[model samples]
Target: MIDAAWLNPVIAFSIGILLSFKLRKISARVQSRRGPLIWLPDRWHDINRSKVLQPLYDIIKLFSKQTIIPSTATPFFIAGPILALMCAVLATLFVPVAGISFDYSFSLVVLFYLLMGEILFIIMGGISSASLFSAIGGVREIDLMLANEIPFILGTFALAITFDTLSIQQMMGFNILINPFAALAVLLSIIVKLHIKPFDIPEADTEIVNGLTTEYGGKLLGVLETARIIMVFVLIALFVDLFLWIPSSGALAWVIFLAGVIATGVLIGFMNSLFARFRIDQATRWLFKIPLLVSVLAIGWAVLWRYVL
Candidate 1:
């Protein structure tokens, strides 16, 4: 029997890979092209099925390549991706999936800090790489982080206030129905966190030569990519658990949870297709202004519902 302690990470990573395939397909369709092809045979009527395992293949290819660290980089350069991946995996442990969660008093708080640590390690890796582009990318990442952090925290705080608890498991309910405004605020914050279109300024390949990852390659880059894949799953799962009320146990619970994840992935992929990347200042201003206001309003509503009303 697989212990949940061992199973959760595998589940999270598998979901992440699946989401990546779906997102790629969505993006391709939006551009009027067929996306990844599955290995299974398509019917004679259907040609050009996109590769479902494309993301997995890409990661494997990266892993097979040789790593060449820059002569100027410090030992810490090697540690960055390692630490970032660790943080992402650690964060996944706290998130509930398929009605199973680690019972901790402050899982949400721990998740937030772990996510921050992931970002921090990425920044450190970029800066320590000693590449000019990487340094710029690291700086841009910091800028993006500063701009998004407050609203994200405020949005999450609204949820905490609404549930009157920081324990992730206890916070489960129909959160979207309870407070659509807070839910929207959090959804937007997550889009930024995922670095989707418009908010993808930190890694704008056109502007920064793939941004912080410009200097990363081979196995190091592979580790970072794996971390990103896992992060995608973790973040989406977090949102689903927080806002979408699925059954707490049984086979139905897993079905509902997976359906929610796919729905969220489709929505995000559509958004990514529709929007162009925002400039740093534009992205920061938008996040700080509208999302912040919505989050503040959410907090107020939570207060009213919990106390005055």
Candidate 2:
């Protein structure tokens, strides 16, 4: 039981790491060329003769590096990434993975609250960093929030309402028998919520080196990068619960679900690389209009299917 207790988080972290490596590979393949050669988790491991243990190399190199804070930046600047990462880890604790729940079933509600805290951390960390680019990134992040949040919330609410339960496991069980539209909403919202593509303008590289993360360096930056990647898996898992749910647990379900996520992410990234970032204002304007309408329509359709039909 103790091993079982630790297993879910370990798997979740491993999956998150694998996804980051996979994203690099997928992004490279999308550009029509082979990237680094394959190894245990990533093909990029064989880039040099020292490639066999590249994952270890990555961690050691990142963790041992210097964390630099700008001269003009406040004391909070040094601590912001750590705080954001802590919030991310705590949020993950609430997210049920691989049929494993936290200490109690009520942990689902805790997950929701923790997720909100992560968002708040992003806002605070970005603003407190004292960089012009970071501030702009913060504004764009908030704008992105305003644009897709309504759709996201309503989409989740639609699932919760239809299933009559906020617990992810219950929703997954219900999805197996009832509607597929909730699955559709989960897939679409994952893309938007992750800010994978066309929606990634908040941290557009052309405008901000790494968006709100421009100022962070060394290990601090690594934590933020890792957190972002972890979020990808977290969102993917949420989508899996909405769709591709299996009656009896099986590894195949996870495989199929992950494949779908990777495919969607690759497509989004390819599209993103092909186009220039839209102005922040333009992005929010379009997202608010199109996605919002689509979500409302989805909710209406789900209601009709459940009742008026």
Candidate 3:
């Protein structure tokens, strides 16, 4: 039997790959385009046909290429992606899969800081690159962080208060059924964090030429992409563990966990297809409004339910 310490990262990595394909297919279908083909007879077409493996292939291809650092880049430039990836992977340790999780009193706090650290590294990478586009992306990332962080914290606080514990495993009850407003707020905040459509202002490819990653290439870029893929799974799994807990034991629990992951991926892809990109100002204002208000109300409700009514 594999230790959960090792098994969790493998599961997370696999889920990330699956999500990449699911998102691609969903987005393609939404746009009335033929989604990825599963198989092709000819070797020439076979490479392109294995749609599920595209992300993996891309990563491998990136690794095979030569790395190029900008002449103006500081030593910290290389450290950025490495640090971001480390933080992202570390964040996964706190999330539970099928009732298996690391137990700690402040797991939630650790998860929060790990995520923040990942973004901070991205910002550092951008600024250190000494590229105009990277600088803009870094600034936008900071803007989005400021706009979404408070509401995210409030939403998590509501959960912590409702559950009366900071350990993620303890908070794994069907809290979404109880305090859906907090769940909604957290979901919205995650959308921003994941850089999904409309909220993808920081790395608006058209506007900033790939944003914070503009100066990154080759194996370094591959590392960043892999980290991002892992993060997609981490964030979605976190949401499922927090909001969509289903009552089951043993094998059944694993099935429900996977279903939740797929459902979340599809929802994210659908939303990405449905919305247009929001400007930075628009994104900031919108995040501060409904999600923040809902989070505040969720906190009030948690308090009331715990104490008064």
Candidate 4:
């Protein structure tokens, strides 16, 4: 029998993977023609006749590509992407996917630690590429992180305050019932955090020819792409837990949660496609100035709701 602990991670990963694929399918369908076949047609058959495996199949194809590194790239460049992917994957272990806390002793602190490492890995990968575009991209990432770190930390602290614990599992227990500004701030921050378009100035394809990833190709690109998708899933899960009370177990709850997440992704993807990329300075200034203030106000309101209400 599979251990319950192990089973939760599998379930969470599967959910994340499925949602990612579904978003891609939805995007393709929206863009105009039918996409590829769903991986499990029989399962969804007799229900909604829709394809859902394009994202997963695309990811698999990426991983199977021949590994190649530019001759001018640093020796460490080849391994950097894998390191980044590993850091993201490890983060999933710390997150309480199905609501069961495991290894509770370290689960709370481990997530922040892993997130820091993931950030470092990304910066390192960019720098180690030894290309000018990559170097500039690395610098841009550092700047972006610096600009947004305050709001991100404050928002996270707000969650900790709500739960009165640093543990992610404990944080999940606290529902976000107060302050629309806080939710909006965090929602916007997540978009910026993911560097989605309008905020994806650092990796501007028109200017830098792929920016930090300009030198990476083949399997390394695959690793980076997987890390990006996985992080997207993780962020959405965090939002769901923070904003809504997820049911312990039931078909309806699962469906509701899935729909909520897909809604978030669609909103984000639409924003990405519709908006033009911002200049780096403009993006940083805008996020830190207005959104940060809104987030602070949201927290203040939440505090009032807790005490004055």
lDDT of every predicted structure (CA atoms): 0.86, 0.64, 0.89, 0.69
- Which regions in candidate 2 have their CA more than 4 angstroms from the true location? 3-5, 39-59, 103-109, 173-181, 250-275
Q: What does the lDDT read for residue 287 in candidate 3?
A: 83
Ranking by lDDT: 3, 1, 4, 2
| TM-scores, one per candidate | 0.95, 0.84, 0.96, 0.83
TM-score computed on alpha carbons, candidate 1 = 0.95
Candidate 2 similarity to native, TM-score: 0.84
Q: Give candidate 3's error at residue 158 in angstroms.
A: 0.9
Over 1-309, each residue of candidate 4 has an lDDT whose tens digit, in order, gives 544555544555566677676556555666774655565457787775544555566678877888777677676686677787887787766655545435464464576667666766876877788888888887788878777766766676666655567766666632556446666776787787778777886688888777788887767888787777777776776676566545556666566566667777777766765677888888888878987897788777767766677
For candidate 2, the 10 contiguous residues with the lowest summed lDDT are 47-56
Tens-place lDDT per residue, model 3, 1-309, is: 765755677788888988988898899999999787566667667345667777888899999999999999998899999999999888878889887877799999999999999999978987899999999999999999998998889988898998899998888867788999998998899899999998998899999998999999998899899889989999899889898988788999999899888888999999989999999999899888889899999999899999998
Q: After superposition, how far is residue 161 of candidate 1 from its true place, in Å?
A: 1.3
Worst 10 residues of 4 by lDDT: 97-106
Query: Between which residue pairs do clashes occur in model 4?
Result: none
After TM-score superposition, what is the CA distance of residue 119 in candidate 2 from its true location, in Å? Answer: 3.2
In candidate 2, which residue pairs get closer than 3 Å at backbone N, Cα or C atoms, i.e. clash?
37-43, 38-43
For candidate 4, give the lDDT of residue 108: 48
lDDT measured at residue 48 in model 2 versus the true structure, 0 to 100 = 50
Candidate 2 per-residue lDDT over residues 1-309, each given as its tens digit: 353435555566677666656665666677787654464445544655423233435666877899887777776665666676676676666555655545443555666566556665766766777888888888888877767667766766676667666676676643633545555555555666676666777677876876787787878777776666667667666665565555455686556656655665565456545655568788878777766777686678668876787
